[model samples]
Target: MGPLNGFTVIELGGIGPAPMGGMILADMGAEVIRIERANGTDPKQMRDVSARGKKSVVLNLKQPEGVETLLRMIENADVLIDPYRPGVCEKLGLGPEVCLQRNPRLVFARMTGWGQEGPLAHAAGHDINYISLTGALFATGRRGEKPVPPLNLVGDMGGGGMLLVNGVLAALLETASSGKGQAIDVAMVDGAAQLMWMFHGFQAIGGWDASQRGANLLDGAAHFYDTYECADGQFISVGSIEPQFYALLKQLAELPEEEFGNQNDPALWPELTDKLAAVFKRKTQAQWCEIMEGTDVCFAPVLSFMDAPSHPANVARNTYIEVDGVTQPAPAPRFSRTPSTVSHGPHSLGQDTEATLAAMGFAESEIKQLLESGTLGR
Candidate 1:
C-alpha cells in the first residue's frame, strides 16, 4: 500500500500541470482517477513521460449525464484537481460549488495560468507566458540575452503542478480537523513568484543583483560553481563553494596555487572561468569523474537522458529502473516502509472505463446508454 493508500483523487481531464499534480498524488499511493473524455482521445498523447502512474475513466462533461457521473465520483473522492480555464468547470456544473455540495470534505483543486480571478484569469497562456509575468523569466539566461525558456519546468510543473500538490495536501490536512473542503486556486503566475522566494531574499540581503542574469552566486557566474567541458566534449558540473570544497576541487584538478585569489570577487570571474575551462578541458570527462566523483567538490558528469539511467550512482541508488522495457526514473523520496513503485506504464484512454464506472456504482445499462448518446464518447 502507498502512503496515500486510502486517498482517492478525481482528476478532471486536462493537460500539463493538472495531470502532473495527479501524478504526485498517485505516486504517494492515492487512487487518481483521470476523468478522460470518451471520444477515444488518448491521454498518453499529451505526455507519455510524466503521464505514467494513473488510471483513467471517460466521461463527457458537455452532457448532463457525464457531469452527473463526475459529481458522483466526487461524492467518494477525497480530492479533485482541474486545470481548465476559469468558468469552464462552473459551466459544466462540476465547479467547486457543486462539488462541495456533493462532498463538502473534498479538496477541490483548481489550477490555471493566471488564477480563478484576475484581469488575465481567462487568458490562454503557456509556461513561458506564465513565468514571464512573475519576474522569473526576466531573471533567466545569460545577462543582456533574451530570456531563454527553461522548457516548462519553471512554470508548468515546478510552479503549477507542484503548487497544486502542496495545496491539495495542505487542504487535506485541514479537512482532517475542520471536516470541510476548500477551493485551491493555484495560479501558475503566483506559484512562479512563490518559487522565487529564495532569489527574492538574496536580493533583499544584497547577495543578488536583480538586473543581471547568470551573474548570481548560484546562477553560474562564479568559476567555482559552474559546468566545465572536458577534452572528450562531455561536461561536468562543479559546485565547490566553501573554502574546503574549493581547495579540494583545485587539488583534485591539479591547479596552481597562483590561480587562487579573492574567491568572491566578481571582477576575477571571467579570467578564472577561462583558466578553469582550460584546465578542465585537458582531461576527458571520465578522467575528471575518476578524480572528483566521490569528493566534497559536489561534482558530477552531465549525463544525457539516455546516460542517466546507467550511471553508477543512479544505478546504485535505484534512482532509475526499467519498466516494460522503458527506462524511467523511479519514484523518489523513499520511505522506510510503504515504499512506492510505478504500478504500470501508461494505459490506453478509458481502458479502465468500465471498471471505474462500475466501482462508482454505474450499471452496465447506464454505461451503454451514456456511450450510445455520444456523451461518454468512447
Candidate 2:
C-alpha cells in the first residue's frame, strides 16, 4: 500500500503540468479520477505519459447537471486539481470558493502559467513564455547567443506541475491536522523564479555574470563543467570543480601539468575548454565512459531517450520500467515501507465512467439519466 492509499483526488483534465501533478499524486497511492471533457481532447494527446496510474471519466461541464454531479463527487474527494484559466472554473461552477463550500476538507490545487490574478494572467502562454518572464530563460545559453529554451522542463514540468504537487501535499498535510481545507495557487512563472534562488544568491555575491550568460562558473564557461564531443560524434560531460577532482581529471586523462593547471582561473577557461575538447574528441564516448563512468572525476556519457533505459547505472537502479509494452519512467522517490508502483498506463477516453460513478455511490438510475442526457460520455 502507498502512503496516500486512502486519499481521493479529482483531476480536471488539461495538458502539461496539471496532468503531471495528478500523475505524481496517483503514483503516490492516491486514487485519481481524471474528469475529461465529454468530447475529448486532441486525438494525438491521448497518449500522454502523465495519464499513467489514473482513471478517466468524461463529463460535459457545460451542462448544469454535470457540474452538480461533479460537486457531489467532490463531497467525497480529498483534493481537486483545477487546470483552467482564471475565471473558467468559477464560470463553470466548480471554482475553489464553490467547491470548498461544498466540501470544507477538500484541498483545491490550481495550476496556471501566470498566477490567478496578474497583469498577464488572462494572456495565453506556454512553457517558453512563462520561463522567459522569470529570467530563467535569459540565464541559459552561450554568452553571445540568444537564450536557449529548456524544452518545457523548467516552466511546465518542473516549476508548474511539480509545484502544484508540492503545494497540494503541503495543504493536504495541513488539512489533516486542522480539519479544514485551503486553496493552493501555483503559477509557472512564479515557480520558475523560485527555481532561480541559487542564481539569485550568486548574483548577490557578484559571482554570477548577469550581463553574459554561459560565463558563470556553473555554466559552460567553466572548462571543467561542460560537455565535450567524442571521436564517434557522441558526447560526455565532466564537472571536476574541486581541486582534488580537477587534478584527478588531468591525471587520468594524461594531460601535461603545465597545460591543465590553473583549474579555477576563469580567464583561462576558454583556452582550457578548447584543449579539453580537442583531447576528448581523440577518444570515443564509450572509451571515455570506460575510463571515468563511476570514478570521482565526475564524468558520464550523454545518454539519449533511447539509450537511457539500457544504461548500466540506470538498469541497476530500475530508473525506468516497461508497462503494457510502453517504456517510460517509473514512479520516483521510493519509500522504505510504502514503495510506489504504476498501477497501469493511460486508459481510453471515459473508460472508467460507469464504474467510477458506481464507486462514487451514484444510484443506477442517476448514472443512466446522466448517460441519456449526454452529460456523461461512456
Candidate 3:
C-alpha cells in the first residue's frame, strides 16, 4: 500500500541513525526486518518511536550457524543497513564483499560518523563531535556563547540516517536499470558538511558574515527573523524577511515608521530589536496570535514537544499520530497515490524470529536445532 511495498530491507540494528533510516523505509512500506543481537541490549523501550513499523529477529552473529542463516537471508534481501564502526561487519564475515557476492543486486548501506577509512574512523565519537567537525555546531547558538548541541538532530538523524536512506534509494534505482548493486558509505561528517552548502554559498558570495555567529541575517541577529518572548513568557518566532512582510509586522506591532523604517540597516538592528522586543512583551502570546498569527507577517508561536501535537495547524494536517498509546509523527512526504502508513507498532525482541526463519525456508527441524544452540534467541 506504500511506495516501497514490494521491497525488503534488512536492518542491522543499532542506536541513533540506522534504526531511524530503517523506520523511514518501513513507513514507506518496505518490509524491513531488524537483525538484533541475541544477547545485545534492546535499544528501543516501550515508547521508542523510531522502532515503529518494523519486525525484529534476534541472531547471534558470533555463531557460525547464525552468520550462515544471515547469508541465506541476504541471498533474497534487497537492502542491508550496517550501522557499526568500520570493520565490525567484516569481523563477522558479513562485509559488503561477502554480502554482495551472495546477492548481486543487494544494496549494502553503511553508516558512520567518520566514514569507512580515515584517521578518526576507528575512534569513538557522537553526534556532537561529528557536527563540531562541520560548521553546523559552531553556527548555532547565541553570539559569545559556546556552541550548543542541536540534540543529535543535525548529525545523527539528518546527516547520518537520512543520507543513508537517500543513498539506498538512489542505489536501488540504479540497480533496477543495470541489474547490479553497490555499496554506500554514509558519513555524518560528510553529510553535515553537505548540509551547510547554503551557508558556504553565502560565504562565497559575501552574503554571509562568517566572522561572528549571531551577526548574520538568519542567526537570531535580525529582529525580523528571531524569536521573541510574549507577555506571558511564552515565545513566538517571526520570519518576516520580505519587505512587505516586515512592513506588516511593523504595522501590526504598532511601531512608528520613524523608529522602524530602516529595516535592513545593521547599525540600527540592535536598537530596533530592543524596541520590537519591548512591544511584543506588552501582549500575551494568545493576543499576539489573534493580531498577527495568520497574516503575511510570517509568525508562529514557539511550541514545545508536548504542545506541538495539539497545535491547530498540525492537528488539521494530522501531522502527529497515536500508535499503541504513544504519540509520534506520522509518515511524511505524502504521495498522491500509494500514501505511506504505519502498518504496526514496535514488536518485542525476536518476536518474528521463528516466523521469519520459517518464511526464509528454514525447516522446522533446523529451526529447532538453531534455537537449541542459542544461535537464535527465544
Candidate 4:
C-alpha cells in the first residue's frame, strides 16, 4: 500500500545490513523475496526484528541449477540487493554484470563494509570497525571517556542498509526515465563518512573542538544540550539552546537566570553544567517532567524500550505496532495516500519456496525436479 507497491525486489540473504535493507523495502510495500541458503538460517535470524513484511525462498547456490534459478528470478526483479564481499557473487555466477545482462532495467545494489575494490575490500569487519575508519566512532563518546559504540545502527543500519535502500530507490526513479538500470556500490565506511559530513564542516569553521569528543556545541559539552541524572537515578534530556528556552529552563528549575551569563560562553560550560546537574539531581525525573514536559524547555525523560511505547507522545502517534505478539516500531516516513502495512512476521527458511517459484513462472514439474535435485529446499 506504499509508494513502492508492485515493485519486485530480490534480496540475497546475508547477515545484518542486507536484511535490514530488504526490510525497509518491504515496509515501503515492495514485494521483497529473500533467498535463504538451502541449509537454512540460524533461529535468531529466522525471528530477526527487521525481517517483517518479506517472503523467504531457499536455494543451494553451490548447484548450477540453483544459480540458474536465481538468474531467472533476477530477470523479473526491479531491484536485486547483493550483500556480500566484492567477488563472492561473481564467483557464484550471480554478480551485477551477469544479473544486469539478464535484466537491463534491474537496479543492482551491493552492500559491503569496505567496498568492491580496496586494500580492505575483502577484510572481515563489523559495524564498529567500519565506523572506526570514518571518524564517526572517534567522536561519539565523552571528552575523556572511551568511545562508545553506537550499537550497529550507525554502520550497519543507518549507513549500510539505509544508504543501500536510498540508492536503490534513486536508481529505480532514474530507470523510470532512462529505461535502464545501474549498479550501486554501497560501503559502510563510505556511508559512515557521508554521515560525518556535518562534523567536518563544524571542524573547518573552528567552532568545533575536534581535539576532545564532548567539547562541542551539540556534543554534551554545553549545559543546555545534555542529559542529566535526576534524584531517583533516572535521566532526562534537555536542549535549551535558544535564549528564551534557556531562560524557561532556569525559571522552571527555580534557578536565578542572572547566574547563567553569556549562554554560548564555552569557558563557562563546566561550571554551568555542574550547576545544572546539581539542580536536576535534586528532583526526580517525574517531578521535573511535571514542570517541563510540555514546555519549550525542550525536555524529555529518557525512556526505556519497555516504557517508550506507552509514553503519551508515542502513544498518540502509534509509533509502535504489535506483530505476532511482539511490539516493534512501525513503518516510518508515513505515506498519506498509499500507506504501508506489515501483513506478517518473518518467514521460516524456504517457507515460501514452492509458492514463490510458482509465482515466478516455474511449473510444478520444474519445482519438483529442482527439489529432487537438492537445488531447491522445500
Candidate 5:
C-alpha cells in the first residue's frame, strides 16, 4: 500500500490534465474511479498512458438517474476531479457546491485552462495557448527563431495536472486537521505563471533579460548551458553553470584557457559556443559520454524517446515499466515507507461499471434498471 491507500477519488472523465492527475493519484494507492460518458470515444485507450492505474465506469450523465448516482458516489469520495469548464459541472448538477453539500469532506478540484471565474474562463484553449499567455512559450526556442511549442509538457502536464495534484494533496492533508474540504480552482495559466516565478525573480534582480527570448543564462544564451550537435548528428546538453563545473567542462573538452576563460561574459558567448560546438562535433554522443557522463561537467546526451528508457541511469532506477505491452514511465518520487506502484494499465470504458456501482451499495435490481434505461453502459 502507498501513502494514499485509504483515499478514494472520483475522476470525471475527460482528456489531458485531469486524467493525468487521476493517474498519479491511482499510482499513489488511491482508488481512482473515472466516471466516463456512456458513448465516449477512447480509440487509443490501451496506449493512453494517463489512464493507467485507474478504474473506469460509464454513466449517461444526461439522465437524472446518472447524476443522482454520481452524487451518491461523491458522498464517499475523498476527491472529485472535474475536468470540464466551470459551468459544465454545475449544468450537470455535479458542481462543487452540490458535491460539497453532499459530502462536506470532499475536495472538489476544478481543472481548467483559464480557471473558474475569469473573462476567459469559458474560452476554448489548449496547452499552447495557455502557455503562450503565461510567457512560458515565448521564453522557449532559439534566438531570432519562432517560439517552438515544447509539446504539451509545460502547460497540460506540468502546470495543469501537476498543479492539481499538488493542490489536492495539500487539501487532503489540511482536511485531516480541519475535518473539512474546499474547492480548488486549478488553472493552467496560473500554474504556468507560477512556474516562471524564478525567471521573474531573476529579471527583477537584473540577472535575466526578459526582452530577448534566448538571452538569459538558462535559455540557451550561455555557451556552458546549451545543447551541442555531435559528429553522429546526435545532441548532448551541458549545464556547467557553476565555476567549478565550467572549469571541469573546459578541461574535459580541452577548451583553450585563452579562448574559453570568461565564462560569464555575454559578449564572448557566441564565439565560445562555436568553439564548443566544433569540439562536440569531433566525437559521437557515445564517445563524449564516455569522457564526461559521470563527471562534474554536468553533461548528458539528449536521447530520443526510443532511446531514453535504455539509458544506464534510468535503467538502474527502473524509471520506465511495461504495462499491457506498452512501455511508459514508472511512478516517480519514491518514498521510503510507502512507495507507489502501478497496479494495472488503462481500463476500457465502463470496464468496472457494475462492480463499482455494486461496491457503492447499489442493489443488483437498481443497477439492472439503470442499465436497461440507458443511464448506465457496459
Candidate 6:
C-alpha cells in the first residue's frame, strides 16, 4: 500500500505519455483502470514497458449506453486521464465538463503535445514534433548537424508524462483540502521548454546561446562532460565537471601536466577531448568500469538496454525485475513505510470490462446488453 492506495484513476487509452503517466500512478498503489475503446483494434500491440500495473476495460463511447457506462465509472473515480487532440474528448462526451459534473472531486488530467486552446491543439504531432516546436530538439546533438532524437525521453516521458503525474497528484492534494477538483492541461511542448529552465537562466545572464546546439556545458562542449567510444566500439559517459573530480579524472587517465594548464579554456576543449578519447580507447569499457565506476572521475560504461539490468549497482538495488518473463525497470522513488509493488502486468483489452462495470454498480442485465450490443468489448 503506497500513498495513492485508495485513489481510483480512469485512464482513457491513447499512446506514449498517457500510458506512462498511468503506470506511475498505478505503481504508487493507485487503482488505474484503462478505458479502452470497444473496437477490433488490439490493445496488446501498444503494451510496452509503460502499460504495466493497470486493469483494462473497454467501452464504445460512440453508443449512448457506452457513454452512460463511462459516466458511471467517472462518478466513482478520483481522477480521469486522457491524451486526446483538444476537441476529441468533448466530442466523445467524456470531456472534463461532463465528467467533473458527475463527480466534482474528479481530477481531470488532459495530456497533449501542444495544450488545449492553442492554434495547434488539434494538429497531429508526436514527441519529436512537440519538442521541435519548443526549440528543445534544436538544442541537442552537434553543431551544424540536424538535431538527434533523444529517444523521446524529454518530450514524452519527462515533459508530458511526468508533468501530468505531478499535476494530478497536486490536484489530488488540493481536492483533499478544498473538497473540489480541477483540470490539468499538461502540454509536452510546454513541459520540454520548462525542462530547459536552467539554460534559460544562463541565456538571461548572457552565458548561453539558443542557436548553438551541443556547444553548451552539459551538451558536450565542455571536455569534462561527454561520451567517448572505446576500442571495442562500446561507449562510456564521463562527467568530471567539478575541479576535484576533474583532477581525479586527469590523474586516473594519466594525462600529461600540459593538458592541465588550461583545464577551463574553451579553446582547449577539442584538444582535450581528442586526448581523452585516445586514452579511453586504449582500454575496454569493462576495464575502465573496474577502475573508475565509483571514483570521483564520475565515469560509467554506457550499457545497452539488455545489459543494464545486470550491472552490480542496479542488481543490488533491485532496480529492475522480471515479470511475466519480461525484464523491465522497477517502479521508482522507494517508500519505506508502505512499499509499492506491481499489481499485475499489462492487461488484455476489456479483460476487466464486466468486473469494472459491476464494481461501478452496473447490473448484470445491463452489462449483458452492453456487451451484446458491442458497447463493451470482451
lDDT of 2 by residue, 1-378 (tens): 778899999999899999999988888999999998867763224566888889989999999999999999999999999899899999998888899899999999989999999799999999999998888999899988999998999999999999999999899899989999998889999899999989889989988877788998987999999999999999999999899999999988888899888888889999999999999999999999989888999998998989999998899999999976778898877989998888988888898999999998999999999999999997
Residue 242 shift from truth in candidate 4, angstroms: 1.9
lDDT of 5 by residue, 179-251 (tens): 9999999999998999999998998999988778888799998999999999999999999999999999989
True-structure Cα RMSD, model 6: 1.3
RMSD of 3: 1.1
Worst 10 residues of 4 by lDDT: 40-49
Q: How many clashes does the backbone of model 1 have?
A: 2
Q: Which 10 consecutive positions of candidate 6 have the poorest summed lDDT?
A: 40-49
Model 2 scores worst on lDDT over the 10 consecutive residues at 38-47
lDDT per residue as tens, model 3, 1-378: 989999999999788999899989999999999999767655345566777888889999999999999999998799999999999999999999999999999999999999999899999999999999988998988888887788999999999989988999999999999999889999999989988989989999988887678778888888899999999999999999999999999899999999999999877878888999999999999999999988999999999988999999999999999998888999987998999999988888888899988998999999999999999985
Q: How many angstroms is residue 375 displaced in model 3 relative to the true structure, after the best TM-score fit?
A: 0.4
All candidates: TM-score: 0.96, 0.98, 0.98, 0.97, 0.98, 0.97
Q: Please identify which of the two predictions, 2 or 4, would achieve the higher TM-score against the true structure.
A: 2
lDDT of 1 by residue, 1-378 (tens): 678888999888788898888887787888888887666557565446555778877777877888887888799899988879999888888888889999999999999999999899988999999999988988888756788888899899899988999999899999999999999999999999999999889999999998888888987789998999999999999999999899898888888878765688988887899999999999999999999999998899998989998888888999987755678778767977888777877777887777887787989998888778866743
| Tens digit of per-residue lDDT, candidate 4, span 1-378 | 888999999998888988888888899999999888867664235567677888888898899999999999999899999988999999999988899899999999999999988999999999999999998888888888999998899999889988998899999999999999999999999999999889899889897876788888888899999999999999999999999998898889888767785789988998999998999999999999999999999999998989999998999999998887789989887999988888688777788899999998999999999999999985
Span of ten consecutive residues with least summed lDDT in model 1: 43-52
Return the number of clashes found in candidate 5. Answer: 0
**TM-score of predicted structure 1:** 0.96
List per-candidate RMSD values in Å.
1.6, 1.2, 1.1, 1.3, 1.0, 1.3
Local lDDT at 37 for model 3:
79
Residue-by-residue lDDT tens digits, candidate 6, 1-378:
977999999998888899899999999999999888766445556446666888889888888888888899999999999888888888988888898899999999999999998789888888999889878889889878889999999999999999999999999999999999899999999999889889889989978888898777888888789999987899999999888898888888888877665778777888788888899999998888888889989998998989999999999999998866689989887999978888788777778889988988999999998889989987
Alpha-carbon deviation at 282 in model 5, angstroms? 0.7
